[model samples]
Target: MIETIVFDVGETITRDDRYWASWADWLDIPRHTLSALVGAVVAQGRDNADALRLARPGIDVAAEYHAREAAGRGEHLDESDLYDDVRPALSSLRDLGTRVIIAGNQTSRAGELLRGLDLPADLVVTSGEWGVAKPQPEFFQRVLEVAQAAPRRTLYVGDHPVNDTFPAKAAGLRTAHIRRGPWGHLWADDPKVMEASDWRIDSLTQLTTLIEG
Candidate 1:
């Protein structure tokens, strides 16, 4: 039985529309252009941040992030940013006695904002806080530590194949490839993703059913 359900923030529990849109605004580029570039990079298996680099070649994204913060336009998250199914799904899982956790490749600020939302999760953490990102053995090690459960009893859910399905599977966690965002849709049916994911879900709501089953 799966005792814990760990989620990826971007494109999993949260929609990234505002995130990319804010970047577009900051970079002074058309939102569509940046969105398209993001899709392109995902298609090529490149880092999502490459979209920003593509928009402004040789741009220092880290520096620009600080610049945006200095100008009072840093990361922002709110209830509206969450997928409609997030609360209901998480609440349902918790109701089933499943330990729900939200851990993703997000910034420390994103972690704080997510915690501020007071979702039904037992824990909400990010790569920035852990000092390790996904697809890294150390990151999954931290997840295992926090879960306090055997790897097989933990289920990791996310949209990205490279960052989510593959490594999580390698860490011995049952993986669910959630089909929601760009990477989700693009790689949902790919052979490797299908192979890596123990389950493929179209919505977070399916997780409750998964746990019950």
Candidate 2:
């Protein structure tokens, strides 16, 4: 039985594409360019530090993520509109006997973004707090410890195959890929994710059936 359901923050639940698109200038790249960099980082098996070198520092990536949400009369709105089915869906999962949590790459600004949205999160695993990014086994270990969960008993869901799915699987968690969008343009392909994810879906609505089946 799956006792815990963990999520990758940006795309998995937060609709990250819109958020990041607003702040693309800081990274000095186009949407496609940033996507290429992420892909290359994953393909080369670079750690978070290495990824940072490619992206550069001092740009406040977190604030940029929030800026998009707060921009232009807030058509999309703040984190409040992150995922249309977020709170209700996660709450439903909790009602069905699963604990829900968020594992994200967030700094203070990122935290502020989430707060502005009024997200009801049980636990958060952040890169700023941990000093590491996901897809690293150590990051998963920390998550398991914080949740007081055994990897085997957990279900991890993420958008990226390279970072979220592969590492989560390696850490012994059952993995799922929420492949709603074309992530291929954004992240490099990794065999580890290519080989080991237990399930893949274009929507979280498909997840419950997979977990129960």
Candidate 3:
């Protein structure tokens, strides 16, 4: 039986539309333009971190990210910031005596943001705090270690094919691909990636039934 449920934060539990749209406004660029650049970068198999550098000439991307992180501190994610199905699924999962965790590739301030939202997770882990990012086996190893979970009994839910589902499954954990995020939607019809996931859902609410069923 699955004892632990590990989740990807961005586009999985929380929607990043407002965050990225705010970034576009800060950069004085059209939101759609920024979105397209990010999508293009990902389409070419590049990291979203590379988008700013590729789109803007002579800008210090690392510093800019740090600045954004600093500015984003103490900011709370409102109910509208999360998907409609998130809270219900999380609550149901927790009530089932399952250990639910939110782990993702986010900045050091991720824990604070998660706390601000009052998510129904037992733990929150981020790449910045762990000093390693996802798709790297070490990160997933840390996740398992922190959760005190055996790989076989753990379930990882995320939208990333290469980053989230692929690696987690390879690590001996089951994976659920949520077809809502950029990576998920972009590779939705790709049999190679989609076939790797143990399960797939269009909405978070479906997770409850998936777990119960």
Candidate 4:
């Protein structure tokens, strides 16, 4: 039985529309342009942030993020940004006595905002808060530590094949590939992703059935 279900933040629990749109506005580029660039980078197995670099050559994304904050434009999250299924699915899992955790490659500020939403989760954390990011063995190690469960009993659900399914499987956690986000759809049929995932789900609601079954 799966005692713990850990989730990826972006494109898993929340929609990333605002995130990319915000960046497009910040860089004064068309939203479609940035979106295409992001998709291109993902297809090439490059960091999605490379889209920003492609938009404005030599632009330091880290420094620009600070500048945006200084100018009163920063990461923003609210209930509307969440996926429609997020609340019902997560709440249902918790109601079933499963441990629910939200962990992903997000900023510490994102972590704070997520916690503020008061979702029915046992813990919500981010790579920025933990000083490590996904695809790193250390990140999954920290996940295992926080979950306090045997790897085989903990399930990691995410959309990104490279960062989510592959690494979590390597860490011994059962992996579920959710077919939601762009990366999710783009690689859903890829051989490696199929090989790594123990389950393929279309929505968070499917998790409830998986756990109960």
Index of the highest-lDDT prediction: 4
lDDT of candidate 4 over 1-213, digit per residue (tens):
999999999999999999999999999999999999999998898889999999999999999999998998999999999999999999999999999999999999999999999998999999999999999999999999988789999999999988999999999999999998789999999999999999999999999999989
Residue 103's lDDT in candidate 4: 98
Model 2 RMSD, rounded to 1 decimal: 5.2
Query: Which has the better lDDT: candidate 2, or candidate 3?
Result: 3
> Which tens-of-lDDT digit does each residue in 1-213 have in candidate 1?
999999999999999999999999999999999999999999999999999999999999999999998999999999999999999999999999999999999999999999999999999999999999988989999999998789999999999998999999999999999999999999999999998999999999999888999
Model 3 residue 140 CA deviation in Å: 0.4
Residue-level lDDT tens digits of model 3 in 77-134? 6788888888899999998888999989987776677777888889887898889999
Per-residue alpha-carbon lDDT of model 2 for 1-213, expressed as tens digits? 788888887667776566444434545568676656655665565643344356665655446555644654222437454667677777677667677778766564565556566655577557777887766777888778766668887888887776777788888898887764445333424455557777766666665666566
Candidate numbers sorted by TM-score from highest down: 1, 4, 3, 2
Model 2: lDDT to the true structure: 0.66
Candidate 3 backbone clash number: 0
List the candidate 4 regions with Cα displacement exceeding 4 Å: none
> Which residue pairs overlap in candidate 3's backbone?
none
Provide the lDDT at 64 for model 4. Answer: 97
Residue 208 alpha-carbon offset, candidate 2, angstroms: 2.7
How high is each candidate's TM-score? 0.99, 0.70, 0.92, 0.99
Global lDDT of each candidate:
0.95, 0.66, 0.83, 0.95
Worst 10 residues of 4 by lDDT: 42-51
In model 4, the number of clashes is 0
